[model samples]
Target: MSYLYLTILFPLIGFIILAAGRDRLSENVAAIIGVGAVGLSALTTLYAGLDFYQQGGMAYNQNLWTWFNVGGFAPQIGLHLDGLSLLMTGMVTGVGFLIHIFASWYMRGDEYGYARFFSYFNLFVASMLVLVLGDNLALLFLGWEGVGLCSYLLIGYYYVNPANGWAAIKAFTVTRVGDVFLLIALFLLYQQFGTLDTVYIVENAHVVLTDSNLAFWTALMLFLGAAGKSAQIPLQTWLADAMAGPTPVSALIHAATMVTAGVYLTSRTYTVFEMAPQVLQFISITGAVTLLVAGFAALVQTDIKRVLAYSTMSQLGYMFMAVGAEAYQAGLFHMLTHAFFKALLFLSSGAVIIACHHEQNIFKMGGLWKKIPFVFACFVVGGGALAALPFITVGYFSKDAILGAVYAHGQIANLPLYNCLYWTGVAGAFLTSIYTFRLIWLVFFGQEKTHAHPIKGVTYWGPLSILLVLSTGVGALLKAPVEKLLTSAQIPVFAIPESLEHAVHGAEHTAVGIALGGLVIGVILFAFAYNAVKTIANTGFGAGISHIWRTAFGFDALYNIVFVKPFLLLARLLGRDPVDGLWLLVPALVKGGHKFTSYRQTGLLREYASSIGLGVVVLLIVLIITQVGV
Candidate 1:
């Protein structure tokens, strides 16, 4: 009955109303419901948050009902909010509310899409809320799959476009592979711990699972699931293509909500990971590799959204590294900062796309700063943050914190992997600047290559302005508060490790030095990239490098050769479909046998009598043989 539970219910009701009333309600009314639902939920969260905080911010739990009861196992659908969950709730709902507002205006032009867009958007918010607030893993997975469904629905919202449709299926199918691993992990955890309750699992993981090998595999499976949802390596390719969705969808899902689900899951189950150091080591490596690859891909991307898409994957890689390195607080901090700035970038990109009449390629755009100077300026700030330009930007704090954790953890654990990650993080920062500035100058500074209609109104500028302010200042101001709130509960699961803290503490000067160094390197790359882009294709070296980056270092091609081609070749080898052929063969054999049997039954009654007498003699011979053998 608490408002905490109502946060999800409001959005669900909104989705149901908008969806069911799509035909009955007018566009404006439907739009209001869509935005209002999230807005109300945001309000509810604010109210609940204030009340909860005033009461010392303790954990709150509410059981709605027992989902089922079987023997001794019963995982109820419920809600739980501690400081961590509250923080996540604030991010999801607060950002979600703004996105809904922006989307209301963004989708206004699409005749029938207004109602449909909000419906899906609201449901997506509701699902993610359920994910972060769910009291048990079963309920969490429900929200998990819900977001996946909503993502597919939203990404392929432009179903008329074949490419969009393919991207949606790719996102859905690829994530399903991870989902399978997650389901298996859930089963394993249940087998080992005998409960799916979030609290119970974390509390009992160590007491229950003493087998180091079993723990390692379970954690690995969980990481695979996290990677799938979060778009990490091997499961990361779909994210870049997810740009096919509407811009609001990009900001909402890619930037703020669905992608972060994996991180939330990992944070909530830190104890499970705490027991498996080997798996954590693997997470660090996967994250480092994914970021480097995505950074490389971002450097050469032509489409604006794709660049942001790759940037997202790269940033996610950093979070994974943080959590893998057992810097849970650092990981969660980065997730928060990322949600603010990345969402800003995407929404700002939305405005630009609108001005350009749906043109997405930055190379095709030029000198838009003079036309929409506000958007141009916003991108600069957003770009600076994305590039992690020095101390002023929040990205520096969150990113540096993670980097420090990696170094400190590496040194403490005596694993050289963390050293490698620290360097990778630094390099990614530099490349991020190069590519981000490349996007900025290409679209806003160069000679006008394509004329764009100017964007003029508060609807476009309002959200961008608010986000710009938050992206710039949020991290610096919230640093101490975030650390305190997250570690306040002081449970071992959410606690910042002493080794990681000492490393971060010792490496303070190193972090500042790295930030400054990365900034300077980024600036140099920016100048070089900005100038080289003009004639890169004409020069041999430039052309080759450009081709490599343009191809996303051949990940797309790798998938084709490794997965797609083999699948097609298999289909060719069994053109009829092997299982389908088996079904056809059954009918064919029956017909052939019937034909053979029919021939034995001649039309003449004497033929029937001869066949019956022959059958009887054959049966007698078989019986005699059987008796002799026995």
Candidate 2:
């Protein structure tokens, strides 16, 4: 019963209590139990993290039991905490608790509120804990699927709506496609390394994968899994549609816990990534492309949460780029900061929506800054952090670290085509700022487009306030330690360019200038466009562009046509028809055999008895003859 186990177990205990007592307990009590469990888990994680830090990055493992032993292979159910898991556990519990608390308020009025909502929320926390704490690949998969199930449950928490249920199914099915590759990659790792333990696999990767190509393919498959979970490239569309869930669930799944699991997996398996540099390059390119695509999509979105959803996808792309560049700590740092601000932004947006009587379209919201001052302030801080507004914000520090990593890779490591990645990342930063501020201006600073309703209670403001503070400070607190931890492995160092240094400071200000330039242009353009298109007739001029943006550059359509349709058709042709034919043949043969057997039956009972007796006599004579011959 070490603190590590307690940190994970507390949430499970809460989940059980809330789930079992759902019918009996009131919504308020259920909320308390759910939030209280996660709050306690957060405290336990903090204590465990402090102990780990005091011990200076040493690894701690607590074995609960032998999970399985067969054919000379044994896997244990255990918890492993190091710098990586410590960071993740803190994020999961801390941010997860806030989301649960927020959900308590957001889901207050719905029927079956306590039973339906908290059950999924608590289960989500428990699944995320298992994901970060598992010591071996098999156990990791269990957590992985657990989180997927919880995600499906939470996304479709309002199952009365068929659309929400469909959205949940879409998410589950898409991610599961990636999960298959993940399972294959794990089996391949075990086949090669003879073990699925993270440490053992990393240490013996060289022995098992003597060929670089094998390692490259294995790592690539694993990255495919990461891509799906992190919502990169072909698998990214589900994240945008995931806005159908409750706002807090969206924040938890998209911003903080489940989405970042892919990047964390890559970081945890850094040595494997190191061995497969080609795979790393592929990851970088995929991330860059996803960033640009999602950024454009975000730019055109009117729904506040959909904008944030696309932003999450874009930010995740940046994270994947960092991981691919071997900037593990930089990526994790961005994740930490992004979690704070993104959650803040969503919760604040939720407040605004609730204040507006559940309206989510930004076009229908304006001049809300006066009505909900606290929420407005929270949005500004969170939005500022997201736009990477100068040195005072968390986004500034974390995003700078990521770009610095890429700059180091290009200038010092002499990695081929690294400069291209560096420039793409810079462009993404600018686009990120533009789209972020566009949402801000449309919702908060614009002309009054809709009448405002008076907001009630501190429930809306409480979570927003807590997150705003964290959004501003988490980066500065963790920056130095993360840097040290990432670089302590004696890996080859990448140097930052002098120009990039100037960019880091204010001396040579091209990057900042570009970012600000994009923001200003986007603000002016969006304001004019939104104002001009106040009526339906004015929107016709850009109808084509609007369609293209709304369709997400037809990526989903292309995937449906190229992959989904063909596979389904082939399944119907080869899988269904042939299998059904075989089944038909078996039944037909059985019918024919029964038809033939019917001829042996006699109408009279005496005839059947005489036949049976004759057959027995014949059998006995044949047996005697066979026995004598033998």
- TM-score per candidate: 0.90, 0.88
Predicted candidate 1 versus true structure: per-residue lDDT over 40-113, tens digit per residue: 99999989878877888677899989999989788888998887888888999988888888887788768546
lDDT of 2: 0.81
Colliding pairs, model 2? none
Q: What is the lDDT of residue 555 in candidate 1?
A: 76
Q: Against the unseen true structure, what C-alpha lDDT does each candidate score?
A: 0.85, 0.81
Evaluated at residue 19, the lDDT of candidate 1 is 89
Clashes of 2: 0
| Runs of candidate 1 exceeding 4 Å displacement | 489-541, 571-630
Top lDDT model: 1
